[model samples]
Target: MIVTIDGPAGAGKSSAARSLANRLGFRFLDTGAMYRAVVFAALEQGVELTDADALEQVAAQLRIELGDQSVLVNDQDVTRAIRTQAITSATRYAADHPGIRALLVDQQRAAAAGHECVTEGRDQGSVVFPDAECKVFLTASERTRGERRYHDLIARGEQVTLEEVLEKQRERDERDTTRAVGALIQSSDAVVLNTDGMSPDEVVDRLYEIVQQRRVAK
Candidate 1:
């Protein structure tokens, strides 16, 4: 079975998906990290963010490997590097380009083939895996999401204020929902799960139960 978990930043999609995959013995694919890797590579090569053509080229050339908990770009480990604020913001530019998203979508599909996978990203169910057996759209209020992100950055020892984190996440939510290519929206058939007061384990348990129900229905 292929499970898709789609949501905006700090909605617990990544953590839930990873844990869900582990619980079910399925492969976990973090599609966001692929775009982040592209951004990281482009910035490393000094490619201008606004240059869509150059960014698309860089995206096409990237060799990204998604492990259970690590990300590798071009054989170099970037698990922690890509999560920095710099790359996180740069990923918006890379992921917003239509050409870059198209290229990455193809890679994402290829990676899921021949495996029971749990995939998470903004457009996983809407665009990348529309036919997934179980599709979940995780969500939370902006304030809740902002607090989650702020604490996450703090835990990573990044010196950032709550106000800054909130502002950036608000901007990201606007861009993600309004982007022309692969815009983030809840798929019509997806089950929307609010994570405002839910723990990661609770979210995954709910998703796993849904998957079980889906299997029986099938």
Candidate 2:
């Protein structure tokens, strides 16, 4: 069985999916980290974010591995490194490239083949696993999402102003929605969940309930 959660950044898709997977005894796949891994590689290679050809080349040659809760890139443990602001900022560029999306989507599919997995990303429901047993599109008010991101960065000891974070969030939102390849969108069959006032536990509960219903129906 595959459960896919698709949403914009700061919507708690990652945390919710991880928790949901654990509760359901399924593997967890964080697809956003794959793009972040590419961004990290680009930075290391001095490849400009706007250089789609170069970025595609870098992605083709890059080796990214996702484990239980960690990520490895080029034989190095960069589980934490790829979450930096720099990689976050450049990830949109990498995700916008068709070549990179095709490659990474294949990797994601291969990783989840023959396993019960909860996968989350901007396009997981629409593109990566449209046939998933459960597909959820999570969303929240921009203000709430921005605040969540701001607090998360501060907690990580990153100096980020709320205003700056909000601005970046808006920029990312625009890019994600307008990007040509695998742009963030809610699949028609996906159950849309507004998470503005919901806790992670609440989200997981609702998702589990949905899963139970599906299982009973089957």
Candidate 3:
């Protein structure tokens, strides 16, 4: 079984997907981190964000490992480094490029080729894994997601204000929904869950039940 949770950034997709995978004893694939790793590497190499050809070249050569708990790029641990607000804002240069999105989609499918997996990203259901057994389009208000992101960043010892985070979150939402390739949209067959005010455990439990129901139906 492959469960796909698709939503915008700052939504609790990562937290809920990780916890749901643990509960279901399934492998977790963070597709967003794949794009983030590419972005992080691109910025590290000083590749211009507007250079799509340069970005594709970097993605094709770098080694991205998606462990159960961490992300490694070129054999270097970049799990935390890639999640910073800087990379988050600059992620679209890679994600929006058709070539880079195609390359990463290949990697994402290969990673889940023979496993029972729970994958989360902006386009998992609509593009990467359209045939997934259980597809979810998780929704959360922009403000709610911003608060979550702001608190998480503060907890990580990163100094950022709620206003800044929310502003960035809005920009991300606009870009994600309007990107040229792999844009974020709810699949026709996906179950839409508005996650505002939902606890982490509650979210996973709901997803778990949804998956179980799908398993029975399958």
Q: What is the C-alpha lDDT of each candidate?
A: 0.90, 0.89, 0.91
What's the TM-score of every candidate structure?
0.97, 0.95, 0.97
User: Which pairs in model 1 have colliding backbones?
Assistant: none
* lDDT (Cα, tens digit) per residue for candidate 2, span 1-218: 99899988899988888888889999999999999999998988899889989999999998888776789988999987888776788788888888999999999999999999999999898999989888889889999999998998888889989999999999999999999889898999888889878988998999898878777866
State model 2's lDDT: 0.89
Residue 104, model 2, lDDT:
95
Off by over 4 Å in 2: none
Model 2 residue 82 lDDT? 86
- Model 2 worst lDDT window (10 residues): 209-218
lDDT of 3 at 174: 93
Candidate 1 global CA lDDT score: 0.90
Candidate 3 per-residue lDDT, tens place, 2-115, comes to 999999888899989999999998999999999999999988999988988898999999999988899999899998998888888888888898999999999999999999
| lDDT for each residue of candidate 1 in 1-218, tens digit (9 for 90 to 100) | 89999998989888889999999999999999999999899989999999999989998888999999999999999999999877787689978988888899999999999999999999999999999999999999988988988898888889999899888998898899999998998999999899778877787889999989888988
Poorly placed runs, candidate 1 (over 4 Å): none
